[model samples]
Target: MKRRPRRTIPATLTALVLLAACVLVAIVAIQLAIGRTPIISYRSVTGTLHSIHWNDTAPLIAGGTCALLGLLLLLAALLPGRPTVLPLTGDMDAGVTRRSLRHALQNTAATVDGVTRAKLKLGRRTIVARIRTDRTNTAGLTDAVRGALDQRLDQVAPLNRPAMKIQLRATRNAP
Candidate 1:
């Protein structure tokens, strides 16, 4: 059987809140069954056959709060999860996992002159390469990284060519 995707954090929290509320209600019902009043102050309207009326302002505020919470939770649940793979070739199965892509990009960036360390973030339409370098000529380093990335990417020729962005972090000492 196909299992549903895991709930997002907000959805999980909402579900937990609902469960806790049901448990609280059950506790109150049990207390009433045993002929004991709940610890909280409340008139037994049903038992006394009294009509209950909700004041406009309080009810409206409460209803609006509930509506907003529901909408927020729905939005959270609908948002897409983090992408795990990047397609590198036209073949359906030819792809690299996000981790592999990061490693590969880092390795490629490390090939650039004066780059001591490289970190890469692969976004939907951009490959952001953050590099630590000892060289002060950041503009030249950026262009070099971009050229290396272009060559590396051309080797695979991914279906979508996400633009490369190079960010340099100058290091005090050369590695």
Candidate 2:
């Protein structure tokens, strides 16, 4: 049986978030159990009752905030950087190969009419292309892109009939 590839970022982030939430809850519970009050101690600078208070609530709040922030950061790191392209899955060693295939697919898609840019994602068994096109002719441009990719890159087995997403944006003036 073939072994499946593993990508841990998503799982790790989820675990981190869960763990942080648990820790925050535990801290809050502990503070509550301790009566949620500051302990004050008195010392003398010049034979006076100058007091110092150890605030258990402050520590609990601070710990909870830090844990929550850490969880948020982990989640943010795990999220995809932008929504410009499709999502892909593959082994670590296939990065370059996948990137090259993606570039080729993008190039092919960009050749279609009204397409301003193309972003491609190549997975282990499938490929997806996202095309940015002018709003006026997006459907036509998408159809043309699909046709062109099907004709030009059919030799690439995994990507022969890739799924295509066309996003219509304002046409930019060429400089």
Candidate 3:
């Protein structure tokens, strides 16, 4: 089945815009509050505070510009991108790792005597396994898969067994 794509936040641009807005607002507000009018000269501004003439407005301007850029970047990140089945390289490491572990669990489930197929999924600290089997009595197979997988995975990744999910599907090929 085709899976829907996922959307995520854009970080870089968002940071730039937020940083620019904060610093610029601070500088402008501080200068205005102190009753100082800056003199603009060729991409620079100069102002005086406390009887001291600061000749460089470049820092303030640069900071403000960076804030604006940061804001714009933040906005750009909010834009939606095409959906994808695979997660982007952002904050999905834990989820991906869980998926890998779940796949492993499913493989283990399929190794049972009567099991025909198995699917597994991992969430947070739990592993869920679904098994399709052809046996009339599934209790034994269920217990076996659970015990075996729990022991095996615990030795490797240490997952919670109580949270494990097992779904058994009975098939017609029972011996």
Cα lDDT tens digits for candidate 1, 84-164: 656666645666666776777789999877899998988878999998987755668888888988988888677678887
- Of models 1 and 3, which has the larger TM-score? 1
> Which lDDT tens digits does candidate 3 get at residues 1-175?
1133332344544557789878876777777678776332312432333334335676577778879877876656565443222232333332224455556667777877888998876654456677887778676888888887877666444322337767777886446
lDDT of 3: 0.61
> For model 1, how many clashes?
0
Candidates' RMSD to native: 4.7, 12.0, 14.8
| Model 2 regions lying over 4 Å from their true place | 1-55, 69-98, 113-140, 159-162, 168-175
Q: What lDDT, from 0 to 1, does candidate 1 have? A: 0.76
Clashing pairs in 2: none
TM-score for each predicted model, relative to the true structure: 0.72, 0.37, 0.43
CA shift at 152, candidate 1, in angstroms?
3.7
Question: Tens digit of lDDT per residue, candidate 2, span 1-175?
Answer: 1223343565676688899978876776676678874222112322332242335666578779989977876766665442222233333322224456677777888887677777777654455776775555344665677787887555454412455554445565344
